[model samples]
Target: MTPIFPAKAGHSVRILQLCRAIKALGHELTFIHVASKLDTQKPDIASHVAFFGERHFLHLDNGPRQARFAFWLRGKLRRRWRKILRGFGHDHSHYSGLDENWRNPWSHQLRAMDRRFDTVVVEYAFNSRALDAFPASTRKLLDTHDAFADRHRPFVARGFRKGYWVSLTPQDENQGLRRADAVIAIQAQEAEHFREQLAQYEVSERNPEIAVVSHYIGLDQPLPDHGVDHAALYLGTNMLSNQISLRQFLEHVLPRVVSSIPDFRLRLAGSICNWAPDIPNVEKLGFVDDLRAAFARSPLSVNPTIAGTGINIKLLDAMGAGVPTISTVTGVRGLGGEFNNGLLVVADHDHAAFADHIIRLSKDAGLRRSLGLAAFADAQRWNERQLAALDHCLRGDALTDTAPGHVARWRDRTPPPFPTAT
Candidate 1:
């Protein structure tokens, strides 16, 4: 069960990719979408039907009216309590939206289903409550897109008033984790964090097994170089973190790049363009229908992320398309360092060096082609490894050599040799 639809957002991409992978593994799928109260956009039901088949696709609206009214009444009371707490200088950081009571209405619906499921995979820890609807013998897995314990701290430290997505206290998050038979963390560091938190909280007699299953992208053959000279692409949604990173890149790095190569052009795509500043040589291609075509038009991609958790799917998408990429160290977090042959990592806040890499790649078509080839090769190998790991995760098998501390086994290996020809 998931709250998000299959869309272009990073998390949504991860969901769709996993679903496809599961189907490819020959297992039938039943998709349950529990719509969030804050979600205003309607999902394209036709696309969902095409992907999951109409019979298997289930979209649950915001429950019955009585349940909705109860939830609303509770929310009002909580707000009143929050206001009272604020006057006394107390902070309440728990996210009530994750409360299992919010999903109570659907429990009966899920229980009423005539079919039996061997395994039930819930998308987020907050939605893990859905697992309770199944028999105790059925396997339950929780796919945590990111760590949520004190999730708001990072955004708050970055000067934002609140976190972009969900935030919950350690105790609250631990409650969700205890319900899963195995927990799927998107990255290694987060896997370790979950283990530590579960141990610390002693939430259950046995903590759920934690598995590291990073994002996967299908590898594409390198397109013949038809890139615009001195042009780079930055594709992202208008999330607050994306806004901050792109704004900083424009303010600090773009000027130096333009000064060195006056013809330099930056292509901004997706909702990010809505907030993009009007600037010279910056072309805004809003809501690109064909991302592969967009990647083909640019010789390289840039992920200037200075803050955020989990792997950056945009970076992975660029690598999958065989485009040479430059990213801040934080941007490449949770990704294997072996892929560095195709990805250039710069220290955060080092604007001059970031610009230097951009300038260098813009001027060297041969180097760009070489790196893009390496990227495509790396993406192929990475996809295989992730698919194997995900298969193990779905089968409830203990992943060998993938323990949190043993990340070096996969992440620190020497990169495979780049293909001599593509």
Candidate 2:
């Protein structure tokens, strides 16, 4: 699947899990993307391009050109039968956007790919022009990492403005939800929201269909470091919520959090955008390449966000290492761990109340230790490796692979297309 985000911005864990799943299942898979060629230019190949595959396709020139030819030749997914039957089997399903730049034109290619495979796994509710692109027989799983429209449109940078797929209106994304065979929500609350919104928008569906799958990171080997322990801290990069959340914590949350504690410092780390505050105890660490050194020194990782969707794997990362942690209710969205057990406390939605909780946690080291111990204990219950298996088990097509036989045999089946009005 195409994941548009950079590897560093928390998408690596999920991608790695997917890679591991494919490997464990013994699937002879191949990844086609511009990254194959770009890896030669990367300084750190060991870290950046770690996934092993039968083929690392360099499609900077050919694939897109083929896709365009396919799009033109196929004229929507169903009509391009002969073109798709070549090279790849008719069973070859397509996924992810080639690039965010192609967000506008990706619908056709995805739709074409949709008809090609018996299952189409969509990561984003991108290009909606080809809404019903999935073949009637093909299983469609919408693995939602985040609520794009909610986070993007109302974010601090482009508040309420329209983005490219003016059609991906909450209305349109909700449409993809209705059309999808199943919906996979990363966080529990978002899974609930997916169900609620689907019904609210009257997308035809029964109940209990949206699957709540937590975002996972496979840590087969134990992490040697437990992270730094100190006062209060916030760390993230480029995300809109990180900008607003940190500001809210520094201005409204930290003072109350440190009211009882003396010399409490809140370190702000990661690549930041739109710097708007100057707090005394706050340390600004712009663009941290290796967070291990930083995590090794900090006491608590604080997340004070009220907006956005998906489980914060960042919070999981902190808890995984037995680091003292505190998060806003919205921040610890899908964690199965308990407060004072895995995480220290959930910041109350009210600013004063939230700060008060942080203040208490910051002042009490005994409390931090107790929480850190509990958090580590809870980490035992979260098996990232198992989560990958469960995700793969969701569909029948995902149940088979290696040789293209099952998919290759589909060359004779006719691909169904959606109505043009959409």
Candidate 3:
């Protein structure tokens, strides 16, 4: 169950891919979407049908009318106060008043269903309370996209404003984890953190087992040997972290590259184009329908992200498309460093080095092809590893053999060291 409908965002893509993976394993899936109070857009029924099949989906207007009214009123007041504070030269960007105790009123409906489910998976820890509706015989799983306990501290430390999302105290987060039979974390680091939190709190007798399951992307066929155009690609949404990093790249890095290679262009796609500044040689192709064709057109991609949690899905997508990419250390977090031949990692805010790498990669076609091949190969192995781990979790088996650092031992295959770009 999820509050978010599948869309173009990373989290949404994870949801879509996960359902597809589950179905591939020959398990019947019933998708249930609990309406989010913040979203007003109607659910895309067609997309849901395409994934879960006809009549296998449920949309619940779960919250009570009184609670909804209170939430709406609070939102209005918060917006008004923000506007007023902005006028006073105060920054209220980090303040997000989220209610962690919000529960679904329609959970009782789950009890009335004629069929009994063997396993019930809830998307976020905040919604793990829904597991209460399922019988004790049903195995409960919580797919935590990111850790919520003190989630805002990282953004604040990096000088970025916090966005709207649930930020729970460790104690509250522990309560949610205790409800699940197994907790699925998006990355290894987060899995360790969850284990630590649960150990520290000692909430319940049911010590939920934690497992690491990264994002999954279908590998794209290798690009043809005709060679790519002399342009780079950047795809992202208008999330605050993207906004900060992209703006910094534009201000600090783009100019250096333009000076070095005057005709070189940077292609921007997706909702991120909405906030990106107008600049020379920066082409804004907003909301491109064909992402594969877009990646095919460019020889290289850039993930200049400096802050955020979880695996970077866009980075994985670029690797899946067999495109060489340059990313910051934070952008490549939780991914296997040994298999990063197609990726160039830079320190955060190191604009000069970032620009230099772009220039060098643009001038070297043979190097680009070498990295792209490595990327494609790594993507295949990574997908297999993630699928295997997910299969184990779904089967209620202990992941002792497939633990974080031990994943490289899968199939007894050793990963080669990343090829240097010099």
Across residues 1-422, which tens digit of lDDT does each residue of candidate 2 receive? 34322444565555455544544544443333433221222223333344442233212222466665664444355335535653363322212222322322444444444225545554555522233655677666666666554443353244422221112345555766665667767765777777777777755645335665555443322234433333555677655556666666667766765565557677766665237466576777765654545555565677776765567767766665566676777777666433336564554467776666666665566666667666655554454323432445344323223121121112233212111110
Model 1 compared with the native: what TM-score?
A: 0.91
Judge candidate 1 at residue 84 and give its lDDT: 78
TM-score of 3: 0.87
Give the count of colliding residue pairs in each prediction: 0, 9, 0
lDDT value, residue 183 of candidate 3:
93
lDDT of 1: 0.78
Task: Give one digit per residue, the lDDT tens place, for model 1 in 1-422.
Answer: 33234365777778877886677666899888776653444677888888788989996666789989887898788778867765674546334446744557788888888889888898877777788899998888989898888877677667675545777778888888878888999877899899999888745787888887788785546757735679999999888889889989999999999999998999998888998989998999988767778977787899999977888888888888888899999999888677667988899899999999999998888888889888887787666666666777677754447533232122333323222211
Model 2 earns a TM-score of: 0.65
Q: Rank the candidates by TM-score, best first.
A: 1, 3, 2
User: lDDT of each structure?
Assistant: 0.78, 0.51, 0.76
Over 4 Å off in model 2, which ranges?
1-6, 21-29, 34-50, 54-120, 127-138, 148-167, 200-209, 218-229, 256-262, 273-279, 336-340, 346-366, 384-389, 396-422
Best by TM-score: 1
